[model samples]
Target: MMTVTDLDCLRGQRRVLSGVSFALDAGDCLILRGPNGAGKTTLLRTLAGLSPAPRGALSTAPEDLVYTGHLDAVKPQLTVAENLTFWQGIYQNAPQDTLNSFDLDELADRPAATLSAGQKRRLGLARLHVSGRKIWLLDEPTTALDADHVARFTDTLQAHCNGGGIAIISTHLDIALPQARTLNVADFAARQDRTADEEADPFLQGAY
Candidate 1:
């Protein structure tokens, strides 16, 4: 389980959100919705432990959290299979046909540099299959996916939740997620003072 209490986050030296709180247990999903610059990404970054939650409580450990931001993090020179293999190794897990899951089996040998934008996005998402972490933090996950792939991704999320994993995704797309809660990030946005130098919060780290 993951928990947040009265969370306040900052971007640079300015606080972008405050008084934010939520709890996500096994098999739950939280969807973040808000306008541009409403701090959705910042909130996720804080939750993922990429940034500090200056004021609040977060319960989790780093090893249990998996975060995928706007960038794909794919190496242009690596093949699809190679990319998945690298992440699979990091998680100390064997390959689990992630390519097939994303319908990239045929393109497994192709270099990421040759893929289209949508294909590259799919490759980025495929990393989810390799991560054995319990908590997922995804930003704009469905950006370049087609309707069919979106549907597949929804099914994947449902399966993950059913297996007792929790996910928080920020997206504008309409996708069905089991037991999903919608959170409008704007509701948590607030302005506050912050010092130029501050250490990151350790409470937000995920469990192994």
Candidate 2:
């Protein structure tokens, strides 16, 4: 199980979100919903431990979590198969059917740079499967994906949850995951007025 208590998130020196709390058990999925700049990414980063949470408690080990942000994290020079293989090495997990898993069989030998945006996104998402972690913290996972691939991604997420994994995704699209519950980050927006220094910080005003 994973638990969050009174979580407060910041972007640089400014607090963007506060008093957020949630809990998830195995086989659960939580979808984060909010308008742009509502601190959805900040909350995800905080949960993944990539960013410090000024005030909160996260009851999960770092080893159990896997985080995927907007970037695909692909090596442009590497072939599709090589990319998955590389991540498998990093995660120290057994090899997965990478080609078939994300419908990249035909492009397995092709360089990642040659692939289109959607293909690169698929390759990035496939890393989640290769990670073999219990908890997933994803940000805008379906950004460049078409409808068909989005469905494929949904199936992949469902399979993960069915196998007792937990997923927390931040996305604007209406992804069809029947069992997934939604959390609107806008509800947790920090109510404090920003100081002059915070207002002048570009990092705070930009996407959190």
Candidate 3:
């Protein structure tokens, strides 16, 4: 199980989240929902250990966590299959059905550089299957995906959760995941003095 206590995150010098707490066990999915600039990505980064929590207790091994950021970490010079193979080598375990899961079987041999934005995103998502990690931290994973691709990705996430894998995703789109807990990052925003104009747009309170 992964546990968090009073996690506070900052973007540059501006404090974003304060007094945030949560616990996640196997087969659990947690979704972070908020408008852009609400620090959803920041919180995910903090959880992934890419950034410090400042003040919090996070229980999880860095190796056990697989983090997929907003950007597709695909190498333009590599082929789609090569990319998956690279991760497979790192994890030393890869799901046999990973190719079909993300509908990339036909594109397996294609160079990642030739793939479109959505296809590159699919390849990025396919890496999760080969990660062999207990926990997944995804930030806006549905980017560049069409409706059908989104549903496909959601199904993959659902299966992972059903198989006792943990997933924490930051996304604005409704993924319809089973038994997933939603976290509103805006609720944990730090209370501080801001100009009246800044206060008017509540969504602008936190930096992305």
Maximum-lDDT candidate: 2
Q: Write the per-residue lDDT of candidate 2 for residues 70-143, one digit (tens) a residue.
A: 99999999999899889989999965576787999999999999999999999998899999999999999999
Candidate 1 positional error at 70, Å: 1.0
Q: Compose the digit string of candidate 1's lDDT tens values, residues 143-208.
A: 888888888888888888999999999988766974998999788878543333322444433310
RMSD of each: 8.0, 3.6, 4.0
Cα-based lDDT at residue 106, candidate 2? 95
lDDT score for candidate 3 against the true structure: 0.90
Ranking by lDDT: 2, 3, 1
Tell me the spans in candidate 2 whose CA falls farther than 4 Å from its real position: 194-208
Q: Which pairs clash inside model 2?
A: 42-208
Give all candidates' CA lDDT scores. Answer: 0.85, 0.91, 0.90
Worst 10 residues of 2 by lDDT: 93-102
lDDT of 1 at 102: 85
Stronger candidate by TM-score (1 vs 3): 3
Tell me the tens digit of each residue's lDDT in model 3 across 1-208.
Answer: 9999999998878888898899999999999988788889889889888888789888888998999997888988999999999989988997899999999999999999999999999999988889988899999899999999999999999988888999999987887976898999999987777787877887887833
RMSD of 1: 8.0
Q: What's the lDDT of the predicted structure labeled candidate 2?
A: 0.91
TM-score of every model versus the real structure? 0.89, 0.91, 0.90
